[model samples]
Structure formats: structure tokens, C-alpha cells
Target chain A: MVEILYFAWVRERIGLPREQVETNAATVADLVEELRAREERYAAAFADLSALRVALDQDLADFDASLDGVREVAFFPPMTGG
Target chain B: MDIRVQSAPFDFGAEAGAFATGHDNAGAVVTFAGIVRDDTGSLQRMVIEHYPGMTERALEKIAREATGRWDLKDCLIIHRHGDLAVGEMIMMVATAARHRKAAFEAAEYLMDFLKSRAPFWKKEITGSGTGWVASKDEDEAALGRWSKE
Candidate 1:
């Protein structure tokens, strides 16, 4: 099971901060595709691929990044920190 | 390098004064502080969220990078999360180096990276409603200057 975490507005839209997913997807994009098919909220939160940033196991990662052996993933909008 | 991520408010003057006092080897010291801005007077507070472990790791990594790139005597980064009222300090960066140029440049680099690469997100809450502060394109652009082309 891979842990999926959401943050900020994405969390607000998905109505969840984190979830566990049992998936056989090979990459972050594939996992996203699977989640998008689960419900309208997931689809809406991930509607625009350009607006989202993905991280695998707490490191910055691309959507096409391989998820082999990865135990955690996160999705969020661009950071506005300082 | 000293890095702090706290929800409690920090005393800016005391922190800055303390940071300046101990750098005997450093000829120049630079400090930068970011304040919650409420230009229209509508913002009640700004809530900042962060990925707990990653935030500290990211900050430390950035601090390490700055130390490597500059001849810095010391550096400090303090950022606050949770509810922050307008005029409150959000974060501060202090750098001490042998020369003014290195001190100034490293501090700017740290600020630029913290604004874009760090994992924190800010949301503005006002009487009208609440909304996330979108990342500025200029901030992303600011980081490009630090990268070697």
C-alpha cells in the first residue's frame, strides 16, 4: 500500500489530507490516472496536470517518475513559502 | 547554520541583534525578514501549512548549500507557521560573511529558494472568505538567477 498525501487547496478540494492506496501503477502519472477514476473529487483536484506538483517519498519528483518501491506520495500546488 | 521552524512568534530585534554579536571573523552581516502584508486592510490572518519532516530537511539542505557556495561565518533561518496576523514576522534570514558581497548574495539566494522550493503554503483569511496565496511567477523566475546556465 502506498500512502498518498494532499496539501493546501488540493486537500480542501479532495476533503482529505491523506489516504492509503493499493496500486500496481508503475509511475506517479499512472497512480494519478487510477485515482482520477475513483471519484469526481479526485478528478477535480487533479484536473489540470500543469497546476499540480508531485513528490515521491518526500522528495520532489515528476509525474512520470517511477514509483517502484515507493511507500509515500504527495500532491500539491506550487509552493508559496518564504 | 541555525534553522528553526516554529509556530511561536519570534522577537525580531533581539534575534537580529544576537545574530550580529557573535561573528568576530565576519566583516559583514546581512539580515532579511518577511512580514505578513495586509495592503487592503482586509486580511484577518494568514495560515501557513508545511510538510513536517520535509520542511526542516529542505531548509537544512538549503542552508548547507549556501554555506558551500559562500565563505559564510554563520547563518540563521527562522520561519513561523500557523495563524499570523498582519505586521507579524513570518520568517527571517541572517547571513554573516567575511565580505559584504558574499553575505548579501547568500542571503538573497536563501530567500529566493525558500519562497519557491520549500514545501510551505500560505492561505489568506479575510471577512469576505478564505483563499490560498497563489505562487507568484516572479518568484519562480527569481530562482533561475541562482542556477548556472
Candidate 2:
């Protein structure tokens, strides 16, 4: 099972902060596609991929990156941290 | 080494001094603090929200990346959450290095990555209503410049 985490507006939109899901997806994009198909809330949260950012196991990464052996995935808005 | 994400206010001077302690090889310590401004114009207050687990991890990753990129002795990052008033300290970053160049560069690098990579969101609460602050494309572009160098 892979742990999926959400943050900020992404969490607000998805209505949850974290979840553990079993998936057969091999890449971040595939996982996102599966998530988008789950429910309207998921679709709405991930509607515009351009406005979002993804990280795998705490490291910044792209959507197309492979998720093999990845234990965690986090979705968040373009950061406004500093 | 100190990382705090709290609703309470912080003492910038105290934090900076603490990070600079016992570092004889460090010739310079650079610190940067971000303060909430009344410049939002219509907003009376701003609410800063973040994902607890993911936020901390993201910050640590950024800190680690900065440390790897620069020759630094230590670094500290503190960010406050919840409602904040104008002029209150929002965040602070401190970096210590053997020279001013690494210290300054690392501090700036930390801020830049924080601005574009950390998962914190801000909302403006005005007399009229509340609205999510739009992420600026310029901020992303600014961060992009760093990757090229």
C-alpha cells in the first residue's frame, strides 16, 4: 500500500489530509489518473495539474516519474512558503 | 536545526543567536525573517494553513538540499500557522557558514525554495469575506531561475 498525502488547498479540496491506497499504477501520472477517476472530489482537487505539485517520499518530483517501490506520494499546490 | 510550525509568535533574535552558537569556524551567519504585511489592502487578517506531516517533511527536504548545496555549519527554519496580524513575523531562516558568500547564498536559496516548494497556503480575511490568495506565476518563474544555475 502506498501512502498518499494532501496539503493546503489540495487537502481542502479533497476533504482529507492522507490516505493509504493499493494501486497497480507504475508512475505518478497513472496514480493521479486513478485518483481522478475515484470521485468528483478527487477530480476537482486534481482538475488542473498545472497548478499542482507532487512529491515522492518527501522529494520534489514530476508527475511522469515512476512510482515503483515508492512508499509515499504527496499532492500540494504550487508552494508559497517563504 | 530547530524547525517549528506553530501559531505562537517567535523571537527572531533569540533563534538566530541560538543557531550561531558554538560555531568557531563560521565567519558569518545570515538570517532572513518574513513578516506579515498590511499590504494585502483589503485584508484585516490572513490565515496560513498547512498540512502537518507533509509540511514538516517538505521543509526538512528543502533544508537538507540547501545544506548539501552550500558549505554550511547549521540552519534553522521556523514558520507560524493559523491567523496572523500585520507586521507579525511569519517565518525565519538562519544559516551559518565559513564565509559571508555561502551564508548569504544558502539563506536566499532556502527562502527561494520555501516560497516555491513548501506546501503552505494563505487566505486573506477581509471585511467583505475570505479568499484564497492566488499563487503568482512570477514566484514560480523566480524559483525556476535557481534550477538553471
Candidate 3:
């Protein structure tokens, strides 16, 4: 199971901050597709791929990147820090 | 180098004074602090949320990159997460180097990276409601200038 996390408005829309999902996905994009298929809330949260940023195991990563051995994935809007 | 990510308020004067004092070998020290602004006049507060583990890691990475790019003697970054009232400090960056140009440029570089790279989000709470602060196109464009060098 991989721990999936969401932040900011994505969290609000998804109705939770994090979850553990059992998946056989090969890449981050595949995982996102799996989650999007599970429910409407996930679909809404991930509707626009370009508006979101992904981090794998706490490091920024591309959606097409492989998720082999990855333990965590975070999805959120572009950061507005500093 | 030092980095702090916390929800508590920090004393800017004391921190800046202490940072400058120990860097006597360095000829210049520059510091920049960002304060919450309430241009609309109705803003009650701004709530900041961040990915805890990743936030620290991202900050360290940015700081390391800044130090690597310049001849910095030392650097410090302090960012606050949580609800903040108008005029409250959101974050600060300090850089020390042998000359003013390096210090100033390093500080600016840190700010530019911190704005977009850090995994923190800000939500503006006003009388009407709350909304996430949208990322500006210009802010993303600002980061492009650093890559050429």
C-alpha cells in the first residue's frame, strides 16, 4: 500500500488529508488514474493535471516517473510559499 | 547554514543581529523578511499549510543550492506556517558573503526559489470567505532568470 497525501484545496475537495491505497500501478500517472477511477471526489481534485504538482517520497517528481518501491505520493496545487 | 520551519513567531531584530555578529569575517550581510499584506483591508488572517517532512527537506535543498551557487559565508532561512495576522512576518532569509553584491544576490535568489519551490500553501481568510492564494505567472517567470547563470 502506498500512502497518498493531498494538501490545500485539494485536501478540501478530497475531504481527507491522506490515505493508503493498494495499487499495482507502474507510474505516478497510473496511480492518479487509479484514484480518479475510485470516486468523484478524487476526480474533482485531480481534474487538471497541469494545475497540480506531484512529489514522490517527499521529493518533486514527474507524473510519468516510475513508482517502483515508492512509499508516499503527495498531490497539491502549485506552492505559494515564502 | 541554518534553517527553521515553525509555527511560532520569531524576533527578527535579535536573529538578524546575531547572524551579522558571527559573520565578521564576511564583509557583507543581507537579510530579507516577508510580511503578510492585507491590501483588501478586509483580510482577517492568512493560514499557511505545508507538508511537514518535505518542507524541511525542500528548504535544505534550496539552501544548499544557494550556498553552492555563491561564495556565501553562511545563510539562514526561517519560515512560519499557520494562521498569521496582517503585518505579521511570514518568512525571512539572510545571507553573508565577502561583498554586498554576493550577499544581495544570494538573498534575492533564496527568496525567488522559496516562493515557488517550497511546499507551502497560503489561504487568505477574509470577511467573505477563505480561498487559496493562486500562484502568479510572474512569480514562475521570476525563477527563469536564475537558470541562465
Candidate 4:
């Protein structure tokens, strides 16, 4: 089980702050593809990757990174940190 | 280390003093406070919204990274949420180190990362209407320089 989280406008667009999913996603990109196929809301929330950023295991990371054994994935806007 | 995300206002002097305690060898303490400014001229108040779990984790990561990069004895970060009046304290960062340079640089680095890399969002209450505060490209550029340097 992998915990997926969202923040900022991404959360507002998806209408959820977090969810747990079972997946065979090899990488973050694969998980994103799976999410985009889940529902219109997910697709709309992830329509533009350029406007989004990803963190794997609570650290800033690229989407191409593998998600094997990863327990958590979080998505948010290009962080306005404070 | 202490990290707080709350609606209450913070006292900078008191917070800094607390972090500097129990470290007799620490010779310098640097503090940075971000105030709710009506810099946009049209903004009357600001509402800061954040994801509860992820926001706290993100802040902790930033603080940890700062600790890794600098030789620091202690650190404190406080961020306010919900509605804020102009000139109210939005965030405060305090760092204690053996030298002035490390304390000052680490404090600045932490603020830079906090401003551009955190998950918190702001909505400006203006005469026009309440709208999300747009993140500036300049803030990203500022943070990018740190990585390159």
C-alpha cells in the first residue's frame, strides 16, 4: 500500500488531501499515469506536470524516480514553502 | 529544534533567546521574521492555507536540510496560518552557531527555502476579491542559486 498526498491547488482540484492505493507502479510517472486514468478529477488535477512537483518518501524528487518499496508520495505546487 | 504551524502570533526576541539557551559555546544567534505586508497595495489581509500532514513534514525536511548544511546548535521555525492582519508576524526562523557567519547564513538559507519550497499557500483579501497569491518566479530563482552555490 502506498499513501498518496496532495496539497494547495492540487488538493482543491482533486477534492482530496490524501488516499491510499495499491499499485504495481514502477516509477512515479507510472503512478501518475494510473492516477490520471482513475477519474476526471485526478486527470484534471494532474493535467499539467509543469505546474506540479513531486516528493517521494518526504523528500523532493523527480517523477522518473522509481517507486519500488516507496511508502508515500506527495504532490503539490512548485512549493511556496512558508 | 522546534517547529510550529499555528495561528498565534510569535515573539521574535523570546523565541531567539530560548533557542540560544543551554549552549554556552554558541557565540552568535541569528533570527529572521517574515511579516504580513500589504506590499501589493491592494491586499487588505492574507489567508494562509496549508495541508495539515504534508505541510508539517515539508517544514521538518527543510529544517533538517538546514541543519545538515550548517554547523548549528539549535534552530526554531514558526509559521502562522489562517487569516492574518497586515504587519503581523507570519514566520520566524532562529539559528544559533559558534560563529556569526554560520548563524547568519543558515538563518538566511532556511528562510529562502521556507519561502520558495514549502507547501503553504496564501490568498489575498483585496478590494477586488479574495484570490490566491501567485508564486513568483523570482522566489524560485533565489532558491536555485543556493543549490548552484
Candidate 5:
């Protein structure tokens, strides 16, 4: 099981903040595809992959990054800090 | 080095004075503060969201990088998350070094990294509506200036 978190509009679109999903996906992209297939809300939240950024275990990572042994995944739009 | 991520507001003058006094041996101290801007005059409040664990880690990494790249005597970063009224301070960064050039450059470097690299998102709530603040391309471009140096 991997914990998934969504922030900003992604969270609003998905209607929640975090969840635990049981998956055997090879990478972040594969996991995204799995979530997108589960519901329309997920599809809408992830419709534009280009607008999103991914993090694995609290570190910024690419979508193609391997999820092996990873425990947490976060999906959000580009940061607008400072 | 000091990094703080909190929902409570901070006193910038006090913090700046404390930072400067704490690093009295340093020849220069530079500080920058960002306030919630209501450019349209319709903005009611700004909401900042952050990934808790990652936010602190990312900030620490940026501060560490700045210290490593410059001859810094001390560095401080304080960022607030949660709802904030217009004109309220959103964040502040301070850097101290042996020279004015290093202090100024390090502070700028910290701002550049914090603007995009940190895991914080801003939502502006105005009289008309609430929307996520889009990341500007110019801000991304600003980062390029540091890479070659």
C-alpha cells in the first residue's frame, strides 16, 4: 500500500487530501494511470499531466521514477511559494 | 541556520534585528520579506497550502545549498502557511556574510529557490472569486540567472 496525497486544486478536484492505495505499479506514471482509471474525479484531477508535479517520499521526482519501496506519493500543481 | 514553517504570523523587524545582532561578526546582513499583494484591490485573503514534511525538507535543502555556495555566516527562513489577510507578511529570508555582495546574492538565491522549488501553493481569495495563483514563467526564468554563476 502506498499513501497518495493531493494538494491545491488537485485536492479540491479529487475531493480529499490523501489516501492509501494498493497497487503493483512499476512507476509513478503507472500509478497515476491506475488512479485515473478508478474514477472520473481522478481523471479530472490528473487530466493534464503537464500541469502537475510529483514527489516520492517527500522528494521531488519525475513521473517515470520507480515506485519500488516508495511509501508516499504527492501530486500537485507547480509551487507558487515566496 | 534557522528554518521555520508555521501558521502564526511573525514580526519582521524583530526577527531581522535579532538575526543581525546574532551575527554581529558578519560584515553584512540582507533581509527580504514578501507580503500578500492585493493588486486588484479585490483580494480578501490569501490561502497558502504546503506539503508538511516535504516543505521543511525542501527549505532546509535550499538553505544548505545557499550556505555551501556562499561564504555565509548565518541564514534564516520563515514561511507562513494558512489564511492570511492582505498586506500581511507571507515569508522572509535573511542572510549574513563577510561582504555585502555575498549577503545580497545569497538572499536572492534563497528567494529564487523558495519561489518555485519549495512545496507551497498560494490561493488568492478575492471579492470575485478564489483561484490558485499560477506559477509565472518569468519566475522560472529568474532561476536561470543563478545556474551559470
Candidate 6:
């Protein structure tokens, strides 16, 4: 099981902050595809992967990154901070 | 190096002063504070959201990179979260170095990286509605020069 977190608009669309999911996904991309298949809201949130950024275990990571032994994942849009 | 991510508003002048005094041997100190800007004249406030643990780590990494690239004596980064009105200071970066050039350059590097790399998200609440602030392509483009140099 891995903890999945959503932020900003992603959180707004999904209607929650974080969740624990049991999955057989091998990579971030596979997990995304699995989440996308869960429901329409998840589909909407993951509709365009390019519009999102993902962090694996608190470090920025590529969607194609392997999920081996990963405990936490967070998804959000590109930051606009300064 | 010092990094602070909090929802509480900070005193810009005081923080800047302390940072300089803390590194008296440094010949130059540079500080930059980002203010909440509402160009549409309809903004109510800006709500900043951040990933708690990741925010600090990302900022520290950025600061560490700046120090590695310059002769920095000390560095500080303070970014606020939650609701902020127009004209309020949202964040500040201070860099101290042996010379003006290094200090200025390092401060700029921190700002550019913080603009894109930080895990903070800003949402604008306006009279009409609320919306997330879109990340600018120009901000991403700004980093290209840093890597080349």
C-alpha cells in the first residue's frame, strides 16, 4: 500500500487530501492509469498527465519512475511560488 | 542556511536586518520579497497551499545549490502560506556573500528556483470567483540560463 496525496486543484477535483491505495502498479504511470480507471473524478484529475507533477517519497519524480518500495506519492500542478 | 515555511506573516525589515547582522563578515547582503499582486483589480486574497515536508526540503536544496555556486556566507528563505491580501509580503530570500556580485547572483538564483521548484501552490480569490495561479512559461525559461552557467 502507498499513500497518495493531492494538492491545490488536484485536491479540489478529487475532493480529498490524501488516501491509501493497495495496488499492483510498477510505475507512477501505471498507478496513474489505475487511478484514472477508478472513477470519473479520478479520470478528470488524471486526464492530462502533462498538466501535473508528481513526487515520490517527497522527492520530485517522473511519472515513468518505478514505484518499487515507495511509500508516499503526491500530485499537484507546476508551482507558482517565489 | 535557514529555511522557514509558515502561515504567519513575517516582518520583512526585521528579518532582513537580522540576516545581515548574523553574517557581519559578509561584504554584501541581498534580499528579495515577493508581494501579492492583483492585476485584475478584483482580487480578494491569495491562498497559498504547500506540501509540508517537501516544501522545506526543496527550499533547502535550492539554497544549498546557490551556496555551492557562489561564495555565500549565509542564506535565508522565508515563505508564508494561507490567505494573504494584496500588497502583503508573501516570501523573502536573503543571501550574503563576500562580494556584491556573488550575493546578487545567488539571491537571483534562489528566487528563480523558488518560483518554479518550491512545492507551494497559490490560489487567487477574486470578487468573481477563485482560481489557481497558473505557472508561467517564462518562469521555467528563466532556469535555462542558470543550468548553462
Q: In candidate 6, which residue ranges exceed 4 Å CA deviation?
A: none
DockQ, model 5, C-alpha based: 0.95
Classify candidate 4 by CAPRI docking class. medium
**Comparison by TM-score, 1 against 2, better one:** 1
Better of 2 and 4 by lDDT: 2
Model 6 residue pairs with clashes:
none
Q: Report how far off residue B129 is in candidate 2 (Å).
A: 2.4
In lDDT terms, how accurate is model 1?
0.94
Per-candidate total of colliding backbone pairs: 0, 0, 0, 2, 0, 0
Each prediction's whole-model lDDT (CA): 0.94, 0.86, 0.95, 0.84, 0.96, 0.95
lDDT of 3 by residue, A1-82 (tens): 9999999999999999999999999999999999999899989988999999999999999999999999999999999999
Top-DockQ candidate index? 3
Candidate 6 residue lDDT tens string, B1-149: 99999999999999998998967679999999999998989999999999999999999999999998896999999999999999999999999999999999999999999999999999999999999999999999999989864
Return whichever of 1 and 6 wins on DockQ.
6
Please state the i-RMS of candidate 3.
0.4
Docking class of 5: high
Across A1-82, the per-residue lDDT of candidate 5 in tens digits comes to 9999999999999999999999999999999999999999999999999999999999999999999999999999999999
lDDT of 5 by residue, B1-149 (tens): 99999999999999999999967679999999999998998999999999999999999999999998897999999999999999999999999999999999999999999999999999999988999999999888999999964
Error of 4 at A47 (Å): 1.8
- For the predicted complex of model 3, DockQ is 0.96
- Give interface RMSD for all predictions: 0.6, 1.8, 0.4, 2.1, 0.4, 0.5
What are the per-residue Cα lDDT tens digits for candidate 1 across A1-82? 9999999999999999999999999999999999999999999999998999988888889999999999989999999888
Measured against the true two-chain complex, the DockQ scores of the candidates, in the order shown, are 0.89, 0.60, 0.96, 0.52, 0.95, 0.92
Point out the worst 10-residue segment of candidate 6 chain A by lDDT: A73-82
Candidate 2 lDDT by residue in tens digits, A10-73: 8888999899999999999999999999999999999999988898987889999999999999
Better of 1 and 2 by DockQ: 1
User: How is the predicted docking of candidate 6 categorized under the CAPRI scheme?
Assistant: high
